[model samples]
Target: MTRARTSLLPYLLLAPSLLFLAALFLVPLLQTIGLSLTENGELSPANYQRMVGDLNFVPSLRNTFVLVLVVVPAQVVFALAMATMLQKLRLGRDIVLWIWTIPLGVSDLAAGLVWLAILQDRGYLNSALMALGVIDGPTPWLTYETPVALFFSVVAAEVWRATAIVLVILVAGLQLIPREYAEAAEVFGARPWTIFRRITLPLLRPSLQTALILRTVLAFEVFAVVYAIGGRNFPVLVGEAFVWQTDNQNTGVAAAYAMLVVVISLASTVFYLRALRTPPEQQP
Candidate 1:
């Protein structure tokens, strides 16, 4: 009886968490999937078909992919550098980290507004450029005609706002790495880059995988930043989803878009897992 009770304890302990996940995530996900497959109470692919046939669909999908490709890599590199610097800092490290991570506390909409203020015509960037004699007039940085500028502005805002998330994860990973490995490598005269390449990076694979997966998923769902900065000019997948639900009042098409975003996110997570797979011997 004691053994049986002990065996049941684990499942009992897991019940609340499992139930919460089912209620909050699994239920909504299943409902969304069902909605994506139905139209007006009948099972149909009309929602998906309409979504695919929409004029904004391809552009939004392409823009989403491009944004993820551009921003994720840049954030990863920048975050890694920042994490490395933080790890090396011996004095005022906490203060520096606190300062660097301030953006993490700012909401995405707020971050977008902040960047919009800087990138808009007559904004700080233009004022600075004009003061520096770099431009004779406002450059129309966020204009519809300047798609490249709009694209880059969204990318810059995303990178600045989210890199700290990756940085925090990497910094935690760096902290877990034993200093002895680096010190031993140094004793054998391994260069800093070589030590990082052969030692630090390989051990940091799990963290990198987690960070990449999370960031890539969020990149797919990015809406507020793009909406705030580019508006209708910069069509993206999540923005299209919002438009279908709000502007068109089509819940079916909105669900389809949501499913597509989920599919892309799952695919990216799978790619990261395969690409960053740690060897059996490397498993902790």
Candidate 2:
């Protein structure tokens, strides 16, 4: 009875979470996958065919991958740098930390819109540039199809909005690392970089893995910012999916795109976990 009770307790504790995931996530996912294969109550491959042949679809996918490739690493790097600085800082630490983390409470849509105002041709950026004589007049930012500029804008917005989340996670991980480890490493005459490489980063693996997985999964769902900044001129995968579903009312094709996005996100998460797996460090 005692053994069975112990096992039952864990299952009982897990039941709510399992049920929540089943109801909110799994069921909707299964329905979406099914919908992608059927339209008007008739099964068909027509949606997939359209998606494959859609001229803009391929480019949109390429653009989305490019955005992820640019944004995720950039956010991670910025987050790591900020985390290190916050860890090392002394004066005004609380104020600086709160400022760094303010974006955590802001929505991606809001962040995108806020940046949209700043980066738009007639917006603050252009106004400043014109004031400084850097440009004689307003220059269009969202209009040009220049890949570098478009990518930079997207990456900046994404990093600015999301880096705080990574910082919080990494900071938490950093805190859990004992100060004694750093002190001991210092006593051994380890350089700052050497201490980080040999001690801090190794202990930070789990937190890094969690942050990477979360950020990567969220990257696939990026829409509002891309839409606000690039519009259809420089569509990303999520924006393309949104256009198909909302604007075009092509539910089947949109479902297909959504399903693909889910698959890619899950696969990327799995890849990150495997790539970042490290042996557990001895804990004090």
**Which prediction has the highest TM-score against the true structure?**
1
Residue 46 displacement (Å), model 2: 2.1
lDDT of each: 0.95, 0.87
The digit string of per-residue lDDT tens for model 2 on 17-111 reads 99999999999999999989997899998888888788788888898888888888888888888889988888998899899999888888888
Clashing pairs in 1: none
Score residue 222 of candidate 2 by CA lDDT: 91
Error of 2 at 62 (Å): 1.0
| Backbone atom clashes (below 3 Å) for every candidate | 0, 0
Least accurate stretch of 10 residues (summed lDDT) in model 1?
Answer: 141-150
lDDT of 2: 0.87
**TM of each candidate vs. truth:** 0.97, 0.95
